[model samples]
Target: MSEFRKCARTAEAAMRSVFPATPLQLNAHLSARFDADIWLKREDLTPVRSYKLRGAFNAMRKLRVSAPDQTIFVCASAGNHAQGVAYMCKHFDVQGVIFMPVTTPQQKIFKTQVFGGDNVEIRLVGDYFDDTLAAAQTYCSEAGAAFLSPFDDEDVIEGQASVAVEISNQLGSAPDHIILPVGGGGLSAGVRSFFGHSTHYTLVEPEGGMSLAAALETGAPVSLAHVDGFVDGAAVARIGDKTFARLSDMNLSDVLAASEDRICATMLEMLNVEGIVLEPAGALAVDALVDVADQIRGKTVVCVTSGGNFDFERLPEVKERAQRYSGVKKYFILRMPQRPGALRDFLETLGPEDDIARFEYLKKSARNFGSVLIGIETSSPQNFEALFRRIEQAGMTYTDITNDETLGQFVL
Candidate 1:
């Protein structure tokens, strides 16, 4: 067996002691929708609700075998990686210090603690992941502890490769194509290495944080100047250095950048229609299929649903993005005449399905007119066309600010 395959086997063996293998179930909803055999390698169903635990367990197991005397492990993360390390610390009965950004969700922090139990210590270090990572590394060096990277280590990559191994074995054949979400690139690198030209591959990443694409462009890993952190699970500012080394040869054509709003639509669909709650990163593979329609149709495809550690508190934001992506919701600044009953006249023009989501009057900018911030939602995208036409016919002046990031951030 190749060294990579050997490591994957070890990872698979280690996982069996903790939990049964995550199911590789064929999804009927997506299958019928795409006219292709759609299978989900449900990493979301793993013990930590992500594939992260595989890497954590494999890396820790190898460390214990090689260094026998080392008992301390440290890592930094805001979500899945923290939970993964915490769980592994409990299993291996080793001391672990996990540092996370203070801005991480309480739900994630709580779960990491729960997984580690008495074996792990949680530290709130910084407001950003990069800062948290630096602190953890420093602490590890000072304490002479082994610092575990979330995705940069060879052992971690080998551990992640086990997912593809299971997919291949469970399906009884190689898939025609595999759609994977790339964050730090561990899962994608490991999976791609295992497949090794046997199966075609597509890498999906968030548009606001295109780490894999950036790595491909630079011929090496590079940190993004700015990244949108909405897809928290996959919104990495840079691909891991080790992972990029393996993925450096990938062509730009194979990578797809999914808009944050477009991704939210997939998240909501899986939740409401498929009864699946996927974190934004978990939805990346599925969302990218829309961008590669011709390549995936009529073929057996597996889209790795990477994680399901979605906090319910973000539901409102998810819903808003989904609505905006579908064009059934819009926020606009309306120049309203200050005449009495003018609001009534505008209301009269809305379609039966149209509902007012928000209405706020801004400071008077002109003598006879007021800047009214209005948010309207309807049952379908077509409703917006009719609504906009009605507003124009009524002689109401308005500017659609639905897609305006700067304006929406401040006003909406």
Candidate 2:
């Protein structure tokens, strides 16, 4: 076996002493839907509700041995990695100084603090993640402390390979295919290192943040001009340098981009149908299953449900995105005649299955005409066709703003 593979096997063994292997169970619902043997590598069940702890544990353990007198560790993360590192710091009885953006949710900050107890100190450094990272790096340099790169370090990648090791052991061999959600490429690169080309891997990235795809396209890691933060867990602007080197040989056929809206729909489906609550990034692999549904039929496949750290407060937003993606809801601006019976006539145009979700009046364009912003939800997408027809027949000029991202952001 290669040195990396041997080290990964050793890391897997060490992990068993710290925490049990996350379950790899066949998912009946997904299996039935996709006509495949769909297994879930339930990383969501980890102590940090993510596979992040495995890497953190492995890296920290190796460090503890290599430098017996080293007691300080530092990391910068807005979510899962912070919790993972902090938890391991507590386990190793080392001082940890974690840096996070000032805008990080209080819930996350509290969770990290709780996991580390008194072993970790959290510093809210800057408003943006970039600034926070810079602050953390400077602190590490000035204090002469060990800095943990969430996904880019050699030791970290070896640690993350433990996931693949566990999967292989649990299944008795590598499965026919494995699907993983990609962020900075740590997990994908690590899993690839252990499994090699024996098992096919489908790497899914958030459509708004396809850093891996960008790297593969350019033959190197490049910073994205824009990144959507909706899928915060996977919204990396650039693929990690070390990670890219490991993943540069990936097949184009194995790469995919999952939309934020589709991910929300998958999250809702898993929660309502399977009682699985997945954060947006966690649902990426499952959502991409649609793109490969026909190809994987009758094959044994594994989808790494990356994390269950979903904030319930975003439920409404998730529902809205899902509704829009499913075409069951819409937003439009109607030019209503400014008269006594105009409102009544407009209401009469709505279909039976349609219900007004939002209504607001804009400035009157003319003394006889006013603009009305309307949000409508329906039981079926087909209902919109009939509803739009009625509005047109009523001699009303309307603009569909549901898919108009700029107006939707500002007005809706």
Candidate 3:
């Protein structure tokens, strides 16, 4: 066995003292849909509701063992990583200072504090994560504290490799394909290192945050100009330097960029259909299965459900995104005649299945015309086509704003 595999095995054993291995269960629903043997490596079921705890525990344990005098540890994260570090800080009885973006959800901040109890101190630093990370590093240096990188450090990668070890042991052998969600690349790189060529690997990242894909294409890590925060858990601007070193040789074709809207749709499906709650990043692997349906068919495939740290407050946004992606909903602006019974005439243009979700009268653009911002929900995308055609035939004009990002943000 390779050095990484050996160290990963040791980390797996050490993890039992903190938490038992997460489940690797066959997903019948996904299997039937994809015509494959779909197994879910349920990292979401961990104590911190993420695989992040494994890395945090391994890194913190090694630090404490190597430097017994070191009692303070620091890290910066907006979500799962913060909770994991806080949990381990409590376990190691060490003080942990966690810095998170000021815009981080209050639910995540509260959970981190609860997990660490008195051992953790949360500092809401900057609005942006880069600013927050810089502030955390500065504080760690000034305080003579150990700094923990969520994915870049060697120890954290070794710890994350434990997930692969557990999956192989539970499955009785290496799976034909292991699909992993990539953020800074800790979990995917670690897992890949442990298995090597013994198992085929597929890496998934958020469509708006294709850091891993960027690294593979450029032969080195490069910062993306823009990153969509929709898949907050896995949306990283750049892949970690250390993690990318391990992934540098990967096939670029195997790197799948999962759409953020599609991820939200997957999240809803897994929740409603399978009773499995997956965050957007957690759903990446499963969502990528659509792109690999043919290759994975009749093969044993594992999709790592990486995190379940979903905030229920985002449910409305999740539902909206899902609807938009599934084409069951739409938004548009209607030009109504500024005369009585014109509203009734416009109402008649809607199909029987179409329901008005939102309607607001904006300013009158002309003496005879007024702008009406409208949202319509229906049973199918085809319904919108029929509804729009009827409106056109009725001598009225409208603009489809469902895909207009700038306009939707302002009016919807």
Question: Which ten residues in a row are the worst by lDDT in model 2?
Answer: 362-371
TM-score of 2: 0.98
Model 3 lDDT at residue 200: 87
Clashes of 2: 0
In candidate 2, which residue pairs get closer than 3 Å at backbone N, Cα or C atoms, i.e. clash? none
For residues 1-412, could you state the per-residue lDDT of candidate 1 as single tens digits? Answer: 6788777877887789987888888999988888889999899998899999999988999999999999999999989999999999999999999999999888889999999999999999988777998999899889999988889999999999989989988998779999999999999999988888889999999999998898788788888999998888889988998999888888899999999999999999999888988999999999987777788889999999999999998899999999899898999988878888988989998999999999997555457888788999999989988998998888888999999989877987
lDDT for model 3, on a 0 to 1 scale? 0.93
RMSD of 2: 1.1
| Residue lDDT tens for model 2, 1-412 | 8899899999999888778999999999999999999999999999999999988998899988998888999999999999999999999899999999999999999999999999999999999999999999999889999999999998999999999999989999999999999999999999998999799889999999999999999999999999999999899999999999999999776889999998999999999999998999999989999999988999999999999999999999999999999999899999988988888998999888999999999555558889899999999999999999998999898999999999987987
Q: Total clashing residue pairs per candidate?
A: 0, 0, 0
